[model samples]
Target: MLFERVESEGLAHYSYIVGDGNEALVIDPRRDCDVYPKMASKEGMRITGVLETHRNEDYVIGSVELSARTGAEIFHADGHLNYRYGEAVEDGMRWKVGRLEVEAISTPGHTLGSMSYLLRDSGGEPWIVFTGDALFAGDLGRVDFMGMDRAEEMAGLLYDSIFDRLLPLGDGVIACPAHGAGSVCAASIADRKWTTLGIERKRNPRLQIESKEEFVEDMAVALEMPPYFKEMERLNLVGAPLLSSLPEPSPLPAREFAIASVEEIVLDTRMELAFGAAAVPGSLSIWLGGVPSFAGWFLPYDKEVLLVDETGDPGEAVRRLRRLGFDSIRGYLAGGMVAWHTAGMESSSIATANVHDLCLRLDRQEKERGWILDVRSGAELQKSGRITGAHQIHLTELPERIGEVPMDRHVYIFCGSGLRAMVAASILKRRGWKDLTVILGGLAGWSSAKCPVVK
Candidate 1:
């Protein structure tokens, strides 16, 4: 048998391709579906089927794209929402692929139709189980998306799926999850790529909750649903457009870029420091690395995005944005920041304040004293107390709640680390907040400096 795990960086999504003899199957593919077909070919196998454990909310699903590319039949569990593509698979339904036996087991907790596929070798012994959002390496799926009222009910279903149906499959079965750590799907997923049922059953914290009520209570933590989730759900139900390949945006010269439409959203994909030093005026600075986690929070799906990478590749930036369904890219600025500087175009810069300097400013009570904006999530704040007098607002909600922030005072933004603060600073800068600075090292840095935290 042949197996390969294709990881989508930034999003932290995992798709798998497994083959025996000449036939293969792809599980939970991303929008860029070419990798599966290529992997199958290298292993001397032909792609025959695609399976999705659940309708994804974070990124666009690639089942349709994969089916189009390889003539594979797409399979998803039966549910209330009728999918525009793929056959509705049911529990206990079994099929064959080369020297393997594939069976679908009902696991409806993450989503109404969530299913986990069990694979057995030709000898009829269990091999691996593709647990979608139902289970992760070290955490279980969140059930709050349906509605807060039904979250507990959904959690109960997840408990049954994990403890009743999944654990019975035995310890030797490899557990391949749809996502890993860093994905917004689960709060505390393990960093490891994969784990066996034996390991998770023994050591996974969520799995150790013996009673259903206890598991439900433990999964009751707060979660923020990104604005793009509703859009992704609608698109997935109707079947996302089949992408033959990834889009390669054009590079516009700095001069034309300057005169180009002001309505286009400028994404500064350079390093945070370079963005702090100099950036195209009004650009949203979300360095190349921040595109996945934070871009969806700010970027609108309908608007055209123009990138300024300077030292990095904008193509990669575009690819990451596209993964989240932001496809209307206008292009990247050619010649990057240097080109804008040479053209005599105006640039803007955001100041940085070290933790000690910020504390000193607060101590002196400087006239026009700035407010320390805590952009960390509520959960993080609960765990690590906020700085005294700091106003709390999650970075995701900052765009809509900008008015709540006092314009009269200078704003020094900070999160757990400095990355989020920089993103928040860029957002404020574009909206004409002139007296803004990013607190380097953020709250963690302040604590390391022995500054007091407000509990």
Candidate 2:
């Protein structure tokens, strides 16, 4: 038997290709799914089946695209809602991929129709179970997607799905989850790729709760839902258009790029320091690596996106946006910001201040009228205390709460690292807040410098 894990970086999504003889199966594929087919061919196998653990809310599902490319039959859980494509798979239903037997088990928790696939070896002994969002390495999937009213009920279902359905499969069964660390699917999922049921049962904090009531109560904590989730859910239900069907984002020179920028959103995906030094005026600054984690919070789905990528490889930015279901990529700036500056096009820069500078400004609090805005999440603030006088608003909630930020006062944006602060600075710049400065190194640098923090 052959097993390989394909990781979609940034999103922390994991898709697998499992084969036995000449037949293979793909589980929970990402939207850009060319990797699976190539891997199968290299292993001298034909992909005959595609399985979805659940209708994901974070990223577009690639089941239809994979099926279309490999002639594979798509399988997902049978109920809760009607999916436009893929065959509805009922619990206990089995399929053969060479010598391996794939059986679907209803594990409704993360979603009402969530399923886990159990793979049996040639001898009919359980080998590995593909637990979708229902289970992760060190944490269980969040059960709040069905709305707050149904959160507790869903959490209870998740308790049953894990303690009753999945755990009963045996301690030796290896658990391969759909997502790994850094995914929003789980609050604190471990960084490890795969873990056996034995290890999770022994060490997972969620599993320590013996009572279902306690488990549900613990899991009912509300999490910040990204604005893009509803859009992703809507698109995944009907099946998003294939990558081939979308308009290809072209590379535009400075002149054409300026023309496009008048109508489209300019997303500058350069690093924080580079963006702070110089950027296309009015462009939103989300570093290329930070796009996957924060783009969904602020980017409008209806508008086309034009990238200002300094890395010269804008295709990667395109792929990251595509995974978030942002298909309206107009194009990328051909020569990046340098070309625009050389062409005499207007550019903007955000001011940067170090931790010591911030401290000096705070010392003169009575004289200087500036607000230190902490854009890190509430959870982060709780983990690592914030500056004494800093105002708190999560970066995701910044747009809605923009009115609260004082336009007259100088705004010094800070996040866990400088990445999110740069993003906040961009948002403020676009919104016409001129007196803005991003605090470099954020709280990390301040803490290292032994700066006082209010817990």
Each prediction's Cα lDDT score? 0.84, 0.88
Per-model TM-score, in order, reads 0.93, 0.96
Q: How many residue pairs clash in all the candidates, one count each?
A: 0, 0
Q: Residues 56-99, candidate 2, lDDT per residue (tens digit)?
A: 98998899889889899988763668788888878998989888
Tell me the TM-score of model 2: 0.96
Task: Pick out the ten consecutive residues of candidate 1 with the lowest summed lDDT.
Answer: 442-451
Question: 1-455 in candidate 1: lDDT tens per residue?
Answer: 78889999888999899898999999989987778888899989999999889988999988888888889998876456878888888898887888898899999888877999999988999989999999899998888888888888888888889989998999989999999998899888999877999999998999887688889899866687999998788777887765545456778888788766387888888777788989888888887788988898998877788888966367678778878888788888888888888988888899987887787777666464567788998878888887777888999999889998877878888886577888999999888888888877755546423336876
